[model samples]
Target chain A: MSRLPPLVPGFVAAGLVVGIIGASLGALFVVGSGADGSILGDPYVRRIVVFTLWQAGLSAVLAVGLAIPVARALARRRFPGRTALLHLFGLPLVLPVIVAVFGIVLVFGGHGWINQALDRLSLGPLGSLYGLQGILLAHVFFNLPLAVRALLLALATVPGESWRLAAQLGMAPAQVFRFVEWPVLRQALPGIATLVFFLCFTSFAAVLTLGGGPAATVLEVAIYQALRLDFDLGRAGSLAIAQLAICGLVAAGLLGLGRSVAVTPELGRATARPDVRRGVGALGDGLAIAIAAALVALPLAALVARGLTGPLSTVLRDPAIWSAAGRSLAVGVSAAALALAVACGLAVATRELRLTYRVRHLATAPDMVAALPLATSVLALGAGLFALLHRVVAVFDVALILVAGINALFVLPYAMRLIAPRMLHVAEAYGPLCASLGISGWNRLRLVEWPSLRAPVGLALALGAALAAGDLGAVALFGTQDTATLPLLLYQRMASYRMEEAAVIALLLMAIAGALFIVLERGIGGREHP
Target chain B: MSTLDLQAVGFRYEDMTMTFTLRVPAGGITALIGPSGAGKTTLLNLIAGFERPVSGRVLIDGVDMAGRAPADRPVTMLFQEHNLFPHLTAADNVGLGIHPGLRLAAPERARVDEALDEIGLAGLGRRLPGQLSGGERQRVALARSLVRRRPILLLDEPFAALGPGLRRDMLALVDRLRRAQGLTVLMVSHDPGDARRIAERTAFVHSGHILAEGPTADVLGPGATPEVADYLGEHV
Candidate 1:
C-alpha cells in the first residue's frame, strides 16, 4: 500500500488559523447572547447599521459605475505610461488608507485646491469635508482604481481571435461594446462590486476620522466605540456579530458570482481594437483616461505638496512621532513575515493535497480557511480576543504581537491569492520532473520552489507590510499610549485639529510605507534573475 | 539494460477502462504510435512507475514494480517541454542527475562534463535554458538522462517541439547513445516517421489497446490494422 506524502505542516497552519478565528467567533456569540436587549433595539444602533449599508452600497455603485467607461477606455487605447498607470492602480490597494484620506482632505477640503479654484471663478466655497460626502469621496478615490484594474484584467481575457473577428466585420464602437465587451463586463461586474462594497462596509479609519458624528458612523467604528469609549462588551460583541453576518453574505454573493471564465493563453498579444483608432471615439477614450488619472493623482499630489509645506521642524522635533514610526516598522516587518509563512504553508498544502493525494475537498479547505478574515472582520477578531484575553493576560503587554497576528490574517486572502496559483503552476509544470529525479524536501525547495516563488512571495510580503503598517483597526482596539503606531498617531493629530502636524505625519507615514514596499519588493522579490 | 513487460495492466481514467499488455525486448528501441489519447503516454508512464496498474504486474526484468516510486525504479523520462529547469545552468541541470543537491565530487563533475560532451553541448553547460535554442535544451535534457545512467529511457515526444531537421538529428543522437550504452528505449510518437527512422519494433495503439506489434516496417506499412491504418492514413 502506497502512503501519501505528509501534508501535516499545511494542515497544522490551517488548523491554527481556524482555532484563532473560531474561538474569536465563539467568544462574540457568548458575549452577545448575554446582552439584556436586542442590540438593534436602540435607534442610534439602527441608524449606524443603516448608514453602514447606505454608504457601502452607494460607494460600490458609484465606483463600479464609473469604472466601466474608464476600463473600456483603457482597454481600447494604448499610450505611454499605460503600463505605469496599471501599476499605479495596484498602489491604492497597498497604499496607507490614512495617508490617502489626508490627500483627499487637502484636495477637496473647504480651503483646498478645488474650492480655491471654485472661489477664483466667483463660485462660493463648498462646505466641510467631514461627512457622508467625505466618506464617499475617499472610498471612490481608493476603489475606482481597484475597480478599473479588475475590469482591465477582465478585458485582457477577451481573445485576440474575437477582436480579429470584430475587426474583419468592421463592427462599430457601439456594436463592438454590445457584442463583445458587455458580456465579459456583465460577468465580472458583480464580483468587483461585492469586493468594493465589502471594503467600504468594514472600513474603520476613514469612517472614524471623517464620520464627524453618529450620522456617519459604521459598524466597525461603532464596535470600536462600544469597546474602548463606552466599555460595553455586550454592545461590542453584538455589533461584531452583525458585521460578521453582513460580511459573510457579501462573501457568499462574491462566490456565487464566481464563474470560471476560460482565458486563452494568447493573452496580451497585440490585437488592435477595431473601433478605437484615431477617431472621435479615440478622443473620448483619451478624455476618460485623463479624468480617471486626475481623480487618482490629484489627491496624492496635493498630499505631498501640503506635507512638504507643513510644520516640518516641529513634527520632526517630536519624540512620539519617531517612536511611533519605529513601532510601525516593527509591526510591519513582523506581520509581513508571519503572513508570508502562513500563506506559503496553505499554498503548498493545497497544491500537494490536490495533485499528489487527489483529495479534492481537503485541498480546498485551506483556501476557505485562509479566506476567513474576509468574513470575520479585523475589529470583530480584535473585540473577541480582547474579551478572551483581557483577564488572563494584559492585552496591552502584547499589543504589537496581537496587531501583527491580526493583520497577517487580514492580508492572508491577498497573500493566498497571489502565491497559491503561482505555486500550483510551478508544481504542475515541474512536479513530474522533480519526482522522477528524486528531488524531494529541501532539495526540491531550494532548487525548484524558491526560484519560481520568489516574485510572488516578495509581492505578498511587500503588500502585507504596507497594508499592515497603515492599518488602524486592530491598533485602535489595542493601542494604548505606548503602542500607538503611525496611523494611530496621524488619527490623533487629525482629531485635535492639528492639520499641519497631521500633514507632516501623513507624509512620514507615506514615506515609511512606500519605503517598506519598495525595499521588500526589490530586495527579496528581485527582478526575475536570469 | 533489462526487459520491460506489462502483464494485462489495467487503469481507469474517468469513464474509460484501459488494458495494456506488451513485452519490450532488452537493449532495443520500441516505438509506440497511436492517435491522441490512445494510451501511448500512459503505457510509458506505467513502465516508468508513474502510474500504478490496478490488476497486473509491471515486471522490469522479472521483478514486479508495484508500490515502487518513480525515483526508485530504474527509469528516466523526458517530456516535450520543461525537461530542463529554466533557471538552472545547463551543467547544474545535468549535475542534478548525479546528486539532487548538485553537490558533485570531481569525478562526478567530470562525468557531467563527459555527458555534455557526448550530447554536443560540451562548453555550453554554463548557459541557462532561456539562453539555449529549443534543440539545444533537449540536448541538455538528454545529457541529464545520460548522466543518470538509468537502464530504461522513456521519451514522450521529447523532440516534438523541434523542426523536422532538428528532430531527425536528435533521433540520430539518441540512436547513437542507445548503441553506445545499450539502453532500452520506449518512445511515444505521433509521427510514424519517427519510428520508421530508428525504432526496431513499433506498436500501433488504438482505443487503449495495442492493436498491432511487429517489425517497424510491417506495422507502419500497408499491412497495419484498420484502426492503425485510419490513424496513420495521411502520413503512411
Candidate 2:
C-alpha cells in the first residue's frame, strides 16, 4: 500500500478518465488536421455557435432565476403533498430527453393541446413550437425542476436558528430573505448554474427536435450535420474544438466554487423553521408555488394525456419498438455495470492514494472522469470514438459496446461524486486499524470496506442505469436501422409524423427506464440513503 | 518481543514540526502524555507506519521499517472511536484480526472465541458494534489487537470516550494483556492518572519535542522538568 502509491488501481481510474478525454482529443486532432479553417467565414457555423450559446445561457439564467422563488416558497410552506412534489421535481433528471421533448411539443407544438384550445378561442393557432422559443421552453422544462431542488436543498440548510432570530426581531419576509436566505442561495448558485449550463450546453435531442433550420442550429446539431448528414469529419472536428474551448473556460470559471461554502455544522439546520407567514406574504408565496408547479407539471401532464390518446395497440405491435426497447435495456445494464465498477475502483484508489501521499493533485482525477463527458458534448465523444472505431470495425458492428462504454464514461463523474465521499470517510475512520491489522489488497476491501459501501454502490448503479437508459446524445449519432435504442426509435417514429406511435413508444420507454431505476435502486438492500 | 526505536525522526504537518529519538525496552508499557495539538497522535501514526518521518529510521528490533506499509509493519492501533465496523458482527470483527479475509479454520475460530472470552465479550460476539456500549466497543478493539498478535501495539486516546471508571478498567486490561502477550506498548493518554495507572515510563511531548522521559513517577513528580511541571499544572 505504501511502497508504490497504489499504482494499479490509480492508473486504471486515471486511465478511464484520461482515455475518454484523449479519445475526444484524438478525434479532434484527426478531424481538425483536415479542417480548412473556414468555420469563421461560414454563416452556418456562425449561426450555430451563436444559437448554441444564446439558448444555453438563456436556459441556465432563466432556470436558476425562476427556481429561487419556487424554492423559497416551498421552503416556508409545508403542505400535504410537499414531499411528493419534491420527488416529482427529481423526475426530469432521469427522464429520457426525447420523452420530455415530446412532452414539451405536446403542450406547445402547433397542433398541441394549447394551440387547439387557442383555435377554439379563435386566436389563430398561436404560432409553431419549433425554433428558439421551443428550444428554450424545452430546456427550461428539463432543467427548472433540477434548479428548484438544488435551491430548495440549500434553503433547507439555512440554520433554523436564523429563522428564529428573524422572527424574534420581527423582520419582514423580504428582509429575512435578504439577510438570511440570500447567502445560502448565492453560495449554491455557482455550482447549480454551472451544472444547468453544461446540461443545456450539451443538449442534443431537444435541439434537433425543436430547433429547425440553420438560424436555430446549435454547435451539437452542427457537429451532427457535419458527421452524419454531410460526411464532413473535418468540420465536426473543428466544431468540437470550439465547443471544447468554451467548456474549458467554463470549467475554469467554476474552479472557485468548491472553496465557497461547504455545508458546516455552523449551519446547524437541526431545528425547525419558525413560521412567519402573514397576509400578503402567504398569498405571494402561494402564487409563486402555484406558478412553478404549473410550469413543471403541465408539459408532463400533456405528455401523459397525448400519449394515452393514441392507437396504443398499433404501437405495441411494432416489432422495431420492442427490439429497440430491449436493446436499450441491455445497453443501459452494460453501461451501469461498467460505470459502477470504474467509479468504485476510482473511489477506492483515490482514498488509498490520499492515505499514502500528501499530494491532493490525484484527488481531482476521479471527478474529472465524469466531468469530461459533460464538457465535451456527447455528439463529440461519439463522433470521436466512432471515427477511430470506424477505422477497424464497422461503426454499427460494435454499437452496443460503444454506447455502453460512452455511457459509462458519461456517468462516471456522477458516480464518483456519489461514492467517493463515503469511500474517503471509511478510509479516514478505519485506515489506521486496517493497516495495523495487516489488512490490505482484496482482503481489506472484502472485510473492512464493503460494509459501508453498499448504499453508495446501489446509488451509483441506479443512477447510471436510469441515465443511460434515457440518454439520446450519442445514440442518436451512432444508431442505424438495426441498432436503434428506445429513444432513437421514438425519435424515428416522430420523424415519420406518426405522432400516435411516437407517444406510445415514449410511454413504454418511460416505463422501462423508471422500472430499471426503481428495481436496481431497491434491489441491493433495505434502503439506499444516497 | 521487539524493541521500538525512533532514531532522529522528524515530521511536519502544515506548520507543525516534530522530531523524535528514543528507545523503549521490549514488552513494556510506555505512555505518551502531551499538551493539545503537540503531535502526540502524529507520533503514534509514525510508529504505526501511517506516516513516514522526514529524516530518520523507524527500526523495529533493529530492522529498518523504511518501505513497509502500515499493513506490512508489525503493529496494531486502537483509535479513539470507529474501532469496529458497524456492519460486522462482534465475532467477525475480531475474526478479522486473525485473518484479513476471516478465512478462519476451526482452530482459528476457537482462537477468535478465546479472544472474545478474554475480553469479557464471549456471548456478545454475535452482536454488532452498534448494539454494544462504549466500554464494550473498546474491549472489542482490544480483543482484535490481542488476536492480531503483533509484537508492538499503539493506542491513540483509546479510552477518551469512556467514563473515568471504564477508562481505568480498560487501562488495567491493557496492562494485563501486555504482561500476557509480552507486547511492547506505547499508549497516548492526556490524563496523568492514566499514565500513573499502567505506564512504566512516561514520555512528555510538547511543541513537537520529547520534553521529558523517565519512569512515570519521576517524570510527573515534584522535581520534574519545568515544561512537564507546567503541563501537569495544579490540576494534575
Candidate 3:
C-alpha cells in the first residue's frame, strides 16, 4: 500500500515550538521557586502591580468609550476619503511604539504644540505631560484606533435589510441605533475590550518611555528594571512569573470570548444609512469623525514635522546610529524568514488535517502552538530563555539570536493568520485535481500552490519584518551595550534626554519599517492581483 | 478500455453507511443519475480512487484496485470547476498529463497539440484559464484528460456550470472523444437529459444504493419505478 510520508516537517516544527515553550516555562518555574517572597511584598512592587491593572483597565475603558461615536459616525457617513481614514487608523498597529510615543511627546509635552498654543493665547500652559495622564494618552492613542476598527467591523455586519427597514419605518437616529445597531455592537464589545485590555496590560515600549518614574511602572518595565537595573534575578524571576500569571488569565478570557483581534478590517459593507442625512445628527457625526481623525493623525504628523526639522544631516553621519540600524535590519530579516518557514509548516499541517484527514479538532493543534507566544508574554519568554541559557553560555553572545527567535514566535500568529486561510483554499480547490494528475510534493508546490500563495506569503513576510524591525520587547531583556537595536538605541537616547537625536532616530526607524514593508511586499508579492 | 466493477464496496460518511455494487462494460458511456446527495458522486469517487471504501474491493479489468493511490490508478477525472489551474496556460496544463513536470520531448509535445486539436482548442493553448470562456475551459480540461489517455474517464458533472446549449456541445465532444480513444466513461449527472443524450446505460442511485439499472429508455421511460418517478417529478 502506498503511504503518504509522515508530515515530518510540519510535525517537527510544531514539536520544536512546544519544546521551546516548555523549556522556557520549566526554567521559569525552577528560578521562580528559588526566589523569596520579600520582593513580591515590596511596597514599590505592589504599587507597580496596582498601577499596571489601573492603567490597563482605564485604557480599555477610555479607548472603547471614545471609539463608539467614531465607529458610529463612520458607519453612517459615506464621505470622500472615508476609506483612507479607516486605513490610516491601521497605522498605530504597525507603527513602532516608541516612534508614536515620541510623536505624542512632541505634541503634548510642556513645550509642545498645545502648550505653545496656550502660551500664545495668554492662557497658562498645562503643567506636565508625564505620569498617569501621559501614559493614558499614549495608550489611548495606540488602542483607540484599534477599537474603532473593531467596532467598525461590527457595525458593518448589521444586515442591510435592517437599515432598509429602519428607513421605511422613519426611525429616528436614536431609535435606529437602539433597534438596529445596538445588539450587534454589544455582542462584539466584550471581545474588543478584552483584546484592548490585554494589549495595554503587556505594553512595554509605550509605558517604558512615557512612564516618567516608578509611580507609573507596568510589570514589563518592572521586569526590565529588576533584571537590568538592580541585577536581581530573584526579583526579576518572581515578577516575570507574576506577569505571566496575569497575562495568561487575561489571554484565557480572550480565548473564551472566541475572538482574535483582526489586524485588518474586512471591506466595509456599504449599508445605506438614510436616517441622519442633513440634520443635527449629521453635524454630530461629522464632528465625531473629525476629532477621531485628528487624534490619530496629529501625532504622526508631529513625528514627520519634527523629524525633517531636527539635525537630519548630523544624525545621518553618526556611525552609532548607522550600526544600530544595521543590527535592527539584520534582526528583522532573520525573524521574517524564520517566521515564514514555521508559518508555512503549520499551515500545511493544518490543511492536511482539515481537508485530507477530516479531523477538525486535531487541526487546531498547530494553531495552538503558533499562538503560544501570545498567551505567554514575550518578555517572560525572553527572561525564561535567558535563565535557561545563562548557565551554559554567555547571554550577551546570543542576544541577537534570542531576540530574533522570540520575535519570530511573537509574530507567528499573525503570519499564520495571513497565510493559513489562503493556503487551505489553494489545497481545497486543487487537491483532487492535483491528486488525479500525479502532482505531489515539489511539483505541486511549484506549479499549483506557489502561484496562488505568493501574494499572501509576501504579505506575511512584510508584516513580520516591519513588526520585528521596530520591536523593543524581547530585545530590551537580551540587549547589551554592544548589541543594541535601533529601538533600543532610540530608547537610550530618550532616557538620557537627547530629544533631538532621538527624534531623528525615531523618524529613521519609522522610515525603515515602511521601506521594509514595501520592499518585501512588492519584491516578493510581485503584483497586487497576481 | 477497461471494465469497471464495484464488488459490494462499502463506505461510512458520518451516520450513513453506503454499500454499492455495479459494473460497466468496457468502452461504453454509463451514466449514474439521481437526486442530489444520493451517493452518485461518491460512487464515481470510489472507482477513481479519490475515496476509499470501508469494505470489499474496486476492480478494474478484474484486478483489485485497493492499494493503488489515485495517481497510480488507471483513471482520470474532471471536476465541476477548477479543472485547470488559473495560473497555468492551456498548453502547460495539458502538458502536465503527458509528463507531470511538462518536460516534453518532441513527440510528447506533439501529443499535447494533437489532443488540443482534437478538442478544437488549437492555437489557443497560450491563453490562461481566466482568459477562456466557460466552454473553452471545460474543453481545455477535456483536452488534458485526452492526453492523459487513461482507459477509464470519470466525469463528475464537469459541464454543470455551462448553459444548456454549451453542455450538450460538451457532451457531444465527450462522445466523440470516447469513441475515438475507446475510453470507458462513468459520468455522474443530475439531469436525466444528460443520460438521454449519449449514455446507453443508466443507473438510478438512491440512498447509497443502485435502485435500478437498465438501458436508458427502459429505466427513464414512462413506466418507471415510483421513487424514480417521484425524483423526476421534483425536478419537473
Candidate 4:
C-alpha cells in the first residue's frame, strides 16, 4: 500500500471535525426556527442587530481616530526605549481580551480609581460604567494600541528616499507629511479602519461586563441573554443567523475594499527622527506620547496596584484559582493545537491549488473565516452552539466543545497571518520546482514545505494558545462550576469583590501568555541569528 | 527541435479588453525588450504560464500549454528581485529544483550539489539567501534553474542587480549553460546591452505590440523606430 502524506490525513481530519461541528450547529438553528421566511420580524432581534452595529461602529471609529496622532508621533520620533515601547504597544494584540477588560474596569469603572478620584474632588458622582460608554471605553482601551501599532507600522513605511527628497527640497514638516507620509497612511488607513471596526463589532466580553441592560446590549450580548438567560432557542437561532448575515456582508465588503488597496513595498531605509525643536510640534509630539502611554499604562497600573494592596495573599492561596488556571491551560493548549492544525491545512491547500481566479478567492477564505468569529462574539457563538448541541450532547461536554470552538475561531486570524505569508512565499519561490519533481502531496510538505514553515507554525501555535488562554467569553456561557477556566475564575473573584485574587490570576495569566509568545518568537526567531 | 513555441499567444488583465500576442522560438536567449507598460514583463509572465492568456496558445515541445498552471509548465522563471526563499540555504534552494516529490534519492542530491559546484558556490549550500551577496543570490537562482533541467527558462531581468563585471560574467555563464542544455530561453530586459549580450534574437515590444522582431543586431540598429530608439536611449 502506498503511504499517504501525513499532512493530508491531518488536514482531512481537522477539516471534517470543524466542518461537521459548524454545519451541524448551523443546521440546528435553521431547523429549530420553524419560520422559514425571514428572521427580521422580531423586534428583539432587530434591536440586537442595530445595537451591535452602533457599538462596533462607535468603538472602531474612536480606536482608529485616536490611533492616528499617536502613530504619527511614534513613526516620526525616536525616543529612548522606542523599540521596547513599540513592542509594548503591540503587546495588547496578544493579551487576552478578558484580561484587558479586567484592567479597564479596575481603572475606569464607577467604583474604579478614576471615578473615586473624581468624587474626592467633590464632582458629582459619574454615572455607572456599565453601558454604551463603558463598552466604547473598553473597546478603545483594548484596540487603541492595535490601531497605533498598525498605523505606526504604516507611517514608518514611507521611503527614506522620499524623506531625503523632501529634505533636499527644503520642505517643512507639514509639507513633508503632506507629500511623503500622507500617501502611505492614506493607503493603509481603510484596511486598518475596517479591521478595527470588525474587531469592535464582534466584541463579547467587553460588552458583557459593561452593558447595563437590553437597551444598551450589543448583538453578541443579546444572543447570550436569549440563550443562557431566557433559554429561548428560537430567538438565539434567529439572532445567530442575523449576526452571520450582517457580519458576512461587512466581511465581504471589507475584502473588496482590501483588494483595491494594493500593498506597496515596505521602504526599508531609516528616515530622520522627529525634530521636536519648535513649540507646537514639540508639544504635539509630547502630548501624543503622553496620551499613548497613559491609555495603556493607567489600566495596567490600576490592575497591578489593586492586586498588590488588596486581597493578594488570599487569592493566591485559593485552590479554586489554581484549578481554574490549570483548566484554562488545558483548554488553551487544545485550542491552539486545533487552530494550528486548521491553519496548516489552509496553507497547504493554498499552495497545492493553482492560482486561478477561483483559487484567488479561496486564498482569502482563511482571512474571512478568522474574522467571522470576531464579528460575532464568542459568547454569542457559544450560546448558539449550546442551544444547537443540547439535542445530542450533554451540557458539560458541550461547554468544553464551546470553549474549543471559541478558541479556534479566535486564534484563526493570528494563525492565518503567521502561516499564510510564509507559505505563499515558499509556494511562489519553490512551487515550480516541487511540481516538476512530481512532489504533489505529503512528501513535499514533510521534506520541503514543513522545514520552511517550522518557525511560522510554532509562532502561530504560541499566538493561538495565548489568545485561547485569555479568552473569557464562551466559557462563561458554557462553563459549569467544575469547568471554570482562569478568566471565569477571575471574573468570579471580581464579581465577589476578591480584588486581590483576581489581580494575582490576571498577572499570572499575562505572564504565562507573554512567556509563551516570547518562547515561540525566540525559538523560531533565533534560527535567523544563530 | 524547438523546446518552446508561442503561437499567437495573447493575454489581457482583468480590467482590460485588449489582448497581447507574441511568438518566440526555442533553444537560445530571446530577449523581450520594451519600455515600462509596454507588456514586456506580461509577455514573460504569459510564457512562464503564471498568467493565462485570454485567447492564444503556448506550446512546450509541440504540446499545447495555454491552460497549464505555472507548476505544470515545463518552464522555470528567474524573477528580477531574486525571489530565492529567504529562509532556505543556497543548496536547499537549488535542491528544490529537484523537487522532493521526485523523492530524489542520493543521486539526485548529487546532481543538485554538482549544479551549485558548477556555479562556483560549491561549499556555500548551508548559507541562507540573506547571507549571500546579490551576485551570489543570482548565481544561486541560476543554479536552481540549471538543476531543474527544464527545457525552457524565463529570466525576468535576473541579472539586473549585479555589478557591471558580475553582470557580464553571469551573462557569459548563462550563454554557456543555454548552449550546453539546448535550453529555450525568453528573457525580459530594459537594458539593450543586456539583450545584445545574451539574445540570439530580440523582440521590441511597445504599447502591447511586438513592433520589431528578428536578429538582435538588426532590431536594435538605427533603422529601428523612434519609439524603440527612445525606449533604448532612456534605458541603455
Report the CA-based lDDT of candidate 4 relative to the real structure.
0.71
TM-score per candidate for chain A alone: 0.95, 0.92, 0.95, 0.87
Instruction: For residue A223, give model 4's deviation from the true position in Å.
Output: 1.2
lDDT scores for all predictions?
Answer: 0.84, 0.79, 0.84, 0.71
Fnat per model, in the order shown:
0.00, 0.00, 0.00, 0.00
How many residue pairs collide in each prediction?
A: 0, 1, 0, 2
lDDT of 2 by residue, A112-176 (tens): 87898998888888677888888888888788888887777787765543453343223456656
Considering only chain B, what TM-score does candidate 1 achieve? 0.97
Candidate 3 — which pairs collide? none
Off by over 4 Å in 4: A5-14, A21-25, A35-39, A116-127, A258-269, A273-277, A355-377, A430-451, A524-530, B1-236
Compared with the real two-chain complex, what DockQ does model 1 have?
A: 0.01
Q: What is the lDDT of candidate 1?
A: 0.84
Please, what are the lDDT tens digits per residue for candidate 3 over residues A357-389?
A: 899999988887787777888788887887788
lDDT of 4 by residue, A1-530 (tens): 68655347435734654564476457646744654456787676678778888888888888888888887777777678666666667667778777777888888776787888988998876677788998998888877777777676677655543443233223456755655567677777788778777777777777777786788887777777777788777777777767766776777667666532111112223454323246888789779878878878888787677666766677778787788778777788789888777767766566544343336655555555544454455655665566667778797766766787677876775776677678878878887898899986678878887788877777777777778878877787788788888887777776787666777888877777777767765675445411
The CAPRI classification for model 3 reads as incorrect
lDDT (tens digit, per residue) of candidate 2 on B115-210: 999988989989988899999988998998888788898988878988999889888888889889999999999899989888999999988888
lDDT of 4 at A212: 65
- Candidate 3 DockQ, CA atoms: 0.01
Off by over 4 Å in 3: A1-6, A38-40, B1-236
lDDT of residue A58 for candidate 2: 93
* Candidate no. 4 TM-score: 0.64
Give stretches of model 2 more than 4 Å off: A1-5, A120-124, A259-275, A433-448, B1-236
